[model samples]
Target: MKLLTLPSFLLLFFETAILSNFVTADTNVHYLDNNEFFKFSNPRQIYGTKPLHIFCYQGKPKYIIHIWQSVILYINHSTDDYNQFDGGSPEHVEKEYLEKRYSWTSGLFSSKSKTFHLNPFNTSCIGIESQDTYSVHLKIIRVDLWNILKLVAGIVFFLSAPTLSKNTLFHYVCGVSSGVCASFLILIYFLSKLFPRKTFMYGVIGAGWTLVIYFLQILWDNMKTILSLYRTYVIWYIVITGTISFILCYRWGPVQNQRTMNLIKWSLQLLGLLLIFFSSHFQEAAMAQVILLLLFTYVPKRWVLAPKMYWKKRFPPKLKPISNDEYYEQGVRETAKALDDLRKYCSSPECNQWKTALKLKDVKRFASFIEGNSHLSDEEILEYETSIREEVTDDSDNGEDAQFSEDESS
Candidate 1:
């Protein structure tokens, strides 16, 4: 009497697990809910600077360093809780940036600020409030040059790959997103060092822009369901797809000279759009999650980072399963061409009589265009030859009427 849905439920659970982030206690130095750290200051204090940290992106959950897309350590000015200077209410200032409700794009009060609280008395208001401009002394931490360079280099290498595929737009989008984030991080790094305050402001701009884009994606995804405008979405999808196509086909995909990659890029985009159109609950948040999952799961496999997953794991990365361009470059296309020819020739009158070569195995082997012997023993070849003879003889007898007319007419 047990139901059949049990296995499907288990599958969904595992799917979620693969997408979840692994967090360490050390990474989460501080854990503050909305009211605890980011609330308004007690009306008792007057003036002082406390360290304030406003984060736009958390690279991974539960990490000690608390890597962010952008971090601005503000020096808050306060009185009652002197250990930390609460940097006025930041919510007013973050109106343009704090859009991703599902994520902490606006960050939290020091979940670990208490541990790192340098100012004994002024610590309370360090990251609170937004009035005291000097109360918030912001510091932008630069991503490791190596990490930044690695992302940049990896993206370049991926693009440089003799095989660029067109089926997986998510992979390309991830590469593009990583490259952009890294480039901006680098720019902010140099700018923060040289220009200081202005650079931090610009960093805020970049961080806001990043969140904005993420939000837009979410909005689009959610709006389809929440807004109930499938027709408009279809229109939007077409416009965007068409525009992206023109850009990729005319400008980047071909000009860069990788047609396979171009095709993959376009195909994925179109498929993603179709998925967006059909799926009722599809949200930007969900799509972003899927993109991230695909990035972690699919891209590495394409790079041959490991062997393929099996049916046991459904929804496994199917991004251009094998890089068509690279395979073609590796002479897969030529082999295919030869096999096609063999298939045709085997069906012809000259070879159809012997019919040995007409078998799929023989044709495929011959089409492989490999020069050396297959190492098959004479016994093995004889066995295969016998099978082919029997099949061909039967086929010839059955089709005699069909072939007889052609021969008689000739």
Candidate 2:
């Protein structure tokens, strides 16, 4: 079973690799929402005689739609009533509903791009209804890469989760999630700056900053312990808790003895720290080191050498033998009192017959018997009592039969 672990992980890794490629290829399908742009290209013989329609649904509050073509063409925009022309062609749309929308005549001979801020709440489609007999290509560019990357990253992350330890996986997920969120917020912040008209961007930015500050404050609160643990385990304080460093050094280093291995590992760790300190992302590396050390120290171990060695060296303390006589006596008294209460409460003729059937004269012996059979369940005790009652009934019947025989003989 243990030998199959590596092979299983390798199989999973290959499967993930193949699936990632499959997903990337599959993203190019003709779903408007999946793509960054919706494209229209005229065929070789076909000119711009037929109208081209681009449908939009579930539109946002604002969409910066950029429409560019290979040749000059007249483009018509729909009003806010997007659903009015649901699945309707441009020719079928009423002329009265056609509003004076965005137009670019500057590049009459060459292809020019026209931008529009469209709200697709009611508008169904953007149409190019020009009757011009020229080959034309149109492209509508929107936000695509970031959204696609997020989806792909999420899929890969989820698939890879089973291969990682809980702590490592948690850190990875938190880091990726926070990094993606921060990147999105930064994008939004810049977008808000560029488009001062979007007032809600400011509120979103403020909320994002507030959450970031709150988390930073929490990190600050635990900064002391974090730093202490890192310094003690990951750096110079290697005599006790540098399990990772010790293992790596002992396994690969040329040193054979414990003292020499410790010295070599400490030196190597110091060198690593120095290199990290000089790097461009010193702060990130430092924090990551701290987190790594924290994880290493807190992770549950199956066998710890230090604890085992300490226990071995320490002498076992002498303990006096404790007697359970007091407890036994207390239990006997309680049982006797309970039986007496039961006997007094059950004063009916049937109860008296049952008591006589039991034939228990010594209450102490009965209590001892009960204590000895205390492990038996309630059902077992009831069954035992029933059997005793049956035996008493049989004995009484036999005595009556013997008395009748004696009377008959007399």
Candidate 3:
């Protein structure tokens, strides 16, 4: 006799082709974890210069041209490895930026730096870090004026192509609007990272959203031509279901729990596939429908960049220390509350053991805090660190979320 868990049982019962579809769908979606990269170097060697590369956020991953946000390249001058210039450890590096840690304010390394913005769109680092200098290189994308022009021009050509060298004025206008709006939306996302000042940042976001609404209006008008009653119901179902699922996962999902993450991730893939399949069914409106869905998904989420700094502005509470009891109880899965607790951990006088101190919760905002601070009691820190080590070493733990559907074919 054999007993199987839901995912296993389902996998066994389903046809190989249908199971393959599930696997393929899961693999196609991009996750931030899949792209993380980091490196540290001697500060002086990389000082006063810039290196160029594209990032993942700018577009889909490309050879060397895509903007990437997963890796962070940091140069600490106070390290013992390089005594020629003043070298500092990661902890020492954090001290210099402590005042700005929890706020929405954004700037470069220091006042003496040449670059005004830390995450400049076109250039890499353009500053100095002699006395405890920290030149941070993050994986971020920048869409500049030239890139915008090129994107708009390309969209115009593509929209005109199907018309066989004689495109209607309305089509040309829509193409131009599509390109300009998308590029500007990208610009807003980049600007939010480079300079996260509240008023300016939110203003750009509001304007960009207005443009998005206008674009959606255009798509809706076109959608009416080809959408049958059945397709309309399917689209509305997807829209409502997708919106609810997104809210539930984003608002309540535990950041540290692998199980919750998997559920949210798979749900997104399913929704994306369903939406695309339905949208593409109407040949007359297929291109517009897909384009609208892509833009809708991409535009809003782009501003929520990785790395604690880029997202701090989204959370506005002042950073003050909280007791461990206060943290685990009231702070569990609450971003603002967890961040405040992490601040307490950072501000602790003994904040050098932070990496091994706190437990991993969903509030990844605490990552930078842990990097250089460790203020827990020795016993507490030891316990936390030991649990982390144990978890890392024990690698045979793979489980799936609960079952969702029946086997269509066996």
Candidate 4:
């Protein structure tokens, strides 16, 4: 073959690059949740692609890990590797293909902008070190596991409270039913805020809605009986409880501090319990049932389950490794961009640690795997990053000052 000029070679390479990498749908990826496995074709892009087109506040992408046939993945923070995965790596597939993106809202409004397209990882024409291009030996130092069963139990009790309302509280059952549904709805909203990524968020939201629908249907069926109870005494109960609940929620509902909010919530719950006990319609059965509902619905979740979830979310969990093929997937790329936006909020040391850990083929690959799976929105992620940075910096300064004082005394 005749020698081509450097520019001509580059142009030809670019032209052929569109066909250089081909990824199959069967590529498996491990998610942070240990029990879950993801395929390359369907990477869990939680924030979706809409945020990618906007450059202002992108967040961390899900981690992309590529491996050769002998693949064992691990994630390590500091010196410890806490998680490991084994993907069947019989052989490597090398084929190049063109990629494009399609938005869910494309047809809603006419836009001339073409979806982003690229060619990813066709190693046929070039040779790169395996260690540089893939995760050859992976180790993860720290990861925390969540108890899904506890969350499920909380949800089940929350949804079942309506059933318990039928026999107890007598004339007050209607109000109690409505109140139970409303309280669970509020709890669901708080869980979504607290553990956005966990299945608990979706579970509570769906179950809460189902409970509301069930309650409304029952209310409609028993409207005549319920309204009959709405005479002077019952009406008074309705008005008083409703007013107190409303005032408590309205005043303390928006408070961002979790501990403070929980304190207020528990105090109000105790007051509600006392009110129900002393109400004219109260029966021993009603009191007992109410106690069970509260025990199952609020007690375990607020005091036991939610705090664990909050801890996991605060520290984040393990990251799974993915391949270059998975990294180049449309969903992965957008998520990676979002992750980068979130990473911008981390401290320089943390950011540098990310760079060292991910050893991605490009900066985009390095952008993968945000601290908390990008569950928080971009703004929230930034706030988290800022607080973490300040805390770490302050601690470091304190350490330095103590060291200096000791040295001076010596």
lDDT of 2 by residue, 152-217 (tens): 443343333333323333434444444433544555577677665556876767787766665556
The per-residue C-alpha lDDT of model 1 at residue 410 equals: 94
Number of the top-ranking candidate, with TM-score as the measure: 1
For each candidate, what is the lDDT?
0.43, 0.44, 0.42, 0.42
Candidate 1 matches the true fold with a TM-score of 0.19
Candidate that scores best on lDDT: 2
The better-scoring model by TM-score among 2 and 4 is: 2
List the candidates' TM-scores in order: 0.19, 0.18, 0.15, 0.16
Cα lDDT of model 1 overall? 0.43
Q: Give every collision pair in model 2.
A: 81-122, 81-123, 82-122, 82-123, 83-122
**1-410: candidate 3 lDDT, tens digit per residue:** 25548778777766575545433321111112222443333334444322211112112333323321122333333432221111133223333333333235534221221112222222222222232333333333333343334334444433433332232343344434444435547656887877758888888787887767765565554464447545777466556655554554446432445554455454444454444433221223434544664565556664445445555767866979889899777755686667667777666776765564466553354555555443355798799999988886664332111122223332
Looking at model 3, report the run of 10 residues with the lowest lDDT sum.
25-34
Better of 1 and 4 by TM-score: 1
List where candidate 4 sits over 4 angstroms from the true fold: 1-15, 20-74, 77-155, 163-410
**Arranged by TM-score, best first:** 1, 2, 4, 3
